[model samples]
Target: MTIHLANRVETLTPSTTLAITAKAKELKAQGMDVIGLGAGEPDFNTPSNIIEAAYRSMNEGKTKYTPAGGLPELKQAIVTKLKNDQGLEYAPSEIIVGNGAKHILYTLFQVLLNPKDEVIIPTPYWVSYPEQVKLAEGVPVFVEGKEQQDFKITPEQLEKAITPNTKAFILNSPSNPTGMLYTKDELTALGEICLKHQVLIVSDEIYEKLIYGDNTHTTIAEISQELKEITILINGVSKSHSMTGWRIGYAAGDKKLIAAMTDLASHSTSNPTTTSQFGAIEAYNGPQTAVETMKTAFEERLNIIYPKLISIPGVKCKKPQGAFYLFPNVKEAATLTGYESVDQFVAGLLEEALVAVVPGSGFGSPDNIRLSYATSLENLEEAIKRIHTFVQNKTK
Candidate 1:
């Protein structure tokens, strides 16, 4: 007899970007020239200084596990970075480092949410938020934001979605999938709503440093002193320092919650890699030049690509204030091409144009698609040309 998987397994959905990346790899193996916009990673290398620090840690033999919360020095560096960059103060005791920002978020859900507790997530969210809430036996309540409002949920929308069981709201600025960021006034409004409802805010600021033009990223914790105790500030070195493989991310929040998360980490993954922790120290303490340089490149690419994408008939995209993604409303493309959904549109684009773009349905929206401008300028130019070709022919 076959044994069934656990009930928790039933609640999980596979990562859509990973699935698309695998398909792209399969096509490449079959001799196709696949341009993948599906990857969520930067195309840049980790900074030399950070790498050197990691090497030094290895030579100095820092391979063993330390405190599960994180190395003290690493936490101190994070504290300094938070205070200097964001005007937020967090002590080492209130910080917990995990394998990645994703893991830190999952730990928060596990620690704070009980079965049937409700989480408010804005639509066009990062794909992982809903699934993680479900894994913790919590329910996800989605608030839909259309293309007209820059994909941002209003404070009124937040108030309407609240229920007796609502426990937290997932807030991501310069958001994944949509690349939509809430302005400072907008965030303050949201913070006020959450404060009134006594709902915790899980602020995912992973792409905090990758914004463009005049757009500034702000933290909910910085909005008010009272909200500081209620907000979980999640960030890491991966996106900004090109240190994704380093497996180091940390959260700053209420001391009790931080301690619980660290206890959970101790019994589970233990301390994040020791060498990586040292590397993360340098990432936070060293020169900020690498991050600025990467931001400059991203901004240049955004300026070059956003206008080009809007010029493609049937594709509608606003210039994202930040982040490397361009989420275009391709519903018209689907209607003209006879594809019933965004997934089908993406499949057709991949098969015909040899380009990979993510369908927005994965992020809780349909009839739209996400294009990541994280690759080189030459690649971006060619991919858009191919997309233009595909769209023109579909019209015919």
Candidate 2:
């Protein structure tokens, strides 16, 4: 019997990054010593305080469903977080909490977009952004953030992409896949363009807390009140606090848009998990110690591993200012290693080197690859060593 699936099912493809990770797991199950660098989350456990809060909540019988948008208390916590961090204030009505940052984005698109509406997505993007736009019957317009400019798109590129159909522009600071951040001046330039065109801004700041060195995160909303009104800021505990399994994410924007997403979410997820919301409350309201500890460890590993990674023949990577991934342009490396494209080179890494990394084609960049350093120092070192040797051997 043939089953007819919805068109979205055909349009929304699976994640290529996850594909590499799954294949690496398959080889590892067969007893190969594979060091997978495709992780999208931190390797650390959820902080004990947060886990204890959730456990305490469930034990205290706070296990029932709360508001569909989110528990009011959780919304207040998010409001406080924004005020403290970005100086952007939001009423509870202007906030909506969903299962995760991804879920919040998916819901935002569902409520905000009509068929044929276009969202300007900067490449290389998080894998789900374009797919979610398609699922919502929206078109995704791509603007490249070239490697020469540290993978950050220029205001000129953004203005050129907007048309009458353009509805929103996604700004992922410390962007996934590339791990590059947009400075305040750069964001202001982009925001001015959005203002002139009346296009919305979707600021995905999931990695705001992971910045290294002197780099600081600036949400577009923070630049001015007008930008704040035009921006929907998305963030959650998944990365900042290593609570990926907690599945709590929220967005702050105009109340009307928030209400629409809340109504849509009521029909969809109903609410974020009861206990997880409790944990998220603690994540924002609790101590700052554990978050710093995990970030420090990631920086140490990056400092240690980056030089070795660049030592590989024909490989060039910008040291990431934030986020856990290192996206390197490997076209030269792939050619020197006798592969036709970066995709085949990625496969060769898994099959021959037993080191797994995501090909950048997944994020809309064909000549590069993304390696997540969200693993142990030991694991990252071993993976880089394997890749370096693989390129050297193939070149010989």
Candidate 3:
């Protein structure tokens, strides 16, 4: 008899960024000089203060399990940070810490979604939203956003997509892939729609601190008092503090939902790493100068890369309000010789210029590609030059 694999395992696809990274690694093994532009992380070191806190914790023998929800000290720190930075109020009991934002999102999907339950996700969404929804035996309903609209769905589109079975909508501002943030007026519009339909809002605010310019990051909970009751706000110290390796993220919401997530976490991962929790405490409670410094760097890089990307032939991109990615519409890339889908465009560019980028198909859109500018200035300049060269060659 042949061995059988689980259907769920068979159906799930590999994360696009990880898959591209692996391919880039394979090419590098063959002695190719690859410039990787597919990563979704800060290329900065963890701040020294936070690192010292972790060291102190380890020296003090804090290498034990914490509460499933989180260490009280860390939770309290998060409370203070949220109140100070985002103007959101939450007690420690209303929060649950997880390995990362993605982990908590997956756990929430599992806990809340039943078979055939619907999740309304705005496209182009974070790559994990639809996949996680599928893994939980739930359906993802995508509402498309066009380039004319800054790739953000409007209230009309959102309302038309909702149905009686819609359980939640995954809302990300300073959104990944697109970097499109909803303005206060836009959130008010969406908030009212969700309120009338009785739909829950899973507001992913991981990129909250990284927003660019005058773009204020608003939580749906703060839009109005009534909407606050139905919003589950997910945030973390990863992007904010360059602590991606520390793996601390959290969710804030109604006590019952928080309790359910806490229960799910208890049976699953049990607790996050202990020393990392100490580090996270410092990340929240410590001086926020490092966060500002990193944001400054990102904004500088964005200013540099956006114009360069748009200058290339057949490439049209809008300046992102937040996040470290540029999603350039490569539809004109098809008009060039030997390029068909966005995937082929990216693969060809990688093979020719040795720059690894992710195709937008993974984010529920075609005709676009994502380039992560989360690297050094030297690397960014070289990558942009190579992309320009590749596009010129393809067109000519």
Candidate 4:
């Protein structure tokens, strides 16, 4: 019997990290040691207080279904967080809590896009953005954020890409693969363009709390009242409090858009996990100690390992201001080592050097690769050492 899938599923590209990760698993199963540098989450456990709060909630008979949008307390917690952190105010009615930021984005596209509507996605993007747009029967128009420009697209390029079909623009500060941030002035310039053209701004600030070295996180919505009215901001506890598994994320914007998203979620997800919402409540309203500790550890690891990573022959990296990943152009190393492409270089590292990395092709940039520093400093050091030796030996 043959079972056909939907056209949307047919058009989808599978996640790019799976191939290298699968091969790494096979090698480990065969008794070969492998170091994986593709993690997108923090290495720390969820803070103790959050866990206790969830347990308390479940024991207190709070394990049932929550409102489709989310619990009032959780919504209020997010509302309060935005006020305290950004001085931006939002009513509970303007927010929708979903299973995760990814799901929230998926739902947002579904509600907002028509078949030919266009979403302007800057290249070297998080893998899911374009795919989600396509699944919603929308078009993804990509403008390259050139490596020379710290992988950020400029206001001129953005304005050029806008067309009558343009519906929204995605801005991921401290971007996933490249940990570069948009300065306040750059954001304001971009915001002005969006205002003139009437394109919605989708600000994915999931990595908001992990900034380092005097860099600060700013939502474009805070630039002014006009920008605030046009931006739909996405955030979650996944990165901020090391609560990836807890699955709590929210979106804030105009009440009508949120209401539409909530209606869609009601039929599909019903609600975010009840226990996780309670845990998220504690994550926001709880102590600040653990969050800072985790941030400090990540920054320390970045400081120690970044220099070593860039020291390898033919590799160039821009020091990241936030997020846990390092995106480096390894094309020169690949050519010097007799490999044809960065993808081949990544596979060679995994197979021969016992280190796994994600090729930049996955993120729409083929000349580079992304290595995460979310593991222990020891593992990161060993992996860098292995890469350095492999490159040197191949050239020798």
**For residues 1-396, could you state the per-residue lDDT of candidate 2 as single tens digits?**
999999877988789987898899999999999998999999999999999999999999999989999999999999999999888889999999999999999999999999999999999999999999999999999999999999989999999999999999999998998888999999999999999999999999999999999999899999999999999999999999999988999999999999999999999998999999999999999997999999999889889999999999989999999999999999999999999999999999999999999999999999999999999998898899899999999994
lDDT by residue for model 1 over 25-89, one digit each (tens)? Answer: 99999999999888687889999999999999999888898899899999999999999988998
Give the higher-lDDT candidate: 1 or 4: 4
Q: In model 1, which runs have C-alpha deviations exceeding 4 angstroms?
A: none
The models' CA-based lDDT, in order, is: 0.90, 0.94, 0.89, 0.95
- What are the runs in model 2 whose C-alpha is more than 4 Å off? none
Per-residue lDDT over 1-396 for candidate 3, one digit per residue giving the tens place of the 0 to 100 score? 999997766778778888889999999999999999998999999999999999999999999999999999988988888788667788898889999999989989988999989999999889999989999999999999888899999999999999989999889998899888989899999999999999999999999889898887887788777888889999898988999888999998888888898899999998988999999999988898999999999999999878888888888997899988999998786567467678888888788899999999888888888988889878888998998888887784
| Per-residue accuracy of model 4 over 1-396 as CA lDDT, tens digit each | 999999999999889888778888999999998999988899999999999999999899998999999999989999999999999999999999999999999999999999999999998999999999999999999999999999999999999999999999999998999999999999999999999999999999999999999899889999899999999999999999999988889999999999999999999999999999999999999997999999999999999999999999999999999999999999999999999999999999999999999999999999989999999999999999999999999983
Each prediction's TM-score against the native? Answer: 0.98, 0.99, 0.98, 0.99
After TM-score superposition, the amount by which residue 32's alpha carbon in candidate 2 deviates from its true location, in angstroms, is 0.7
Candidate number of the best lDDT: 4
Tell me the spans in candidate 4 whose CA falls farther than 4 Å from its real position.
none
Clashes of 3: 0
* TM-score of model number 2: 0.99
Rank list by lDDT: 4, 2, 1, 3
Structure candidate 2, residue pairs in collision: none
**Residue 394 error, candidate 1, Å:** 1.9
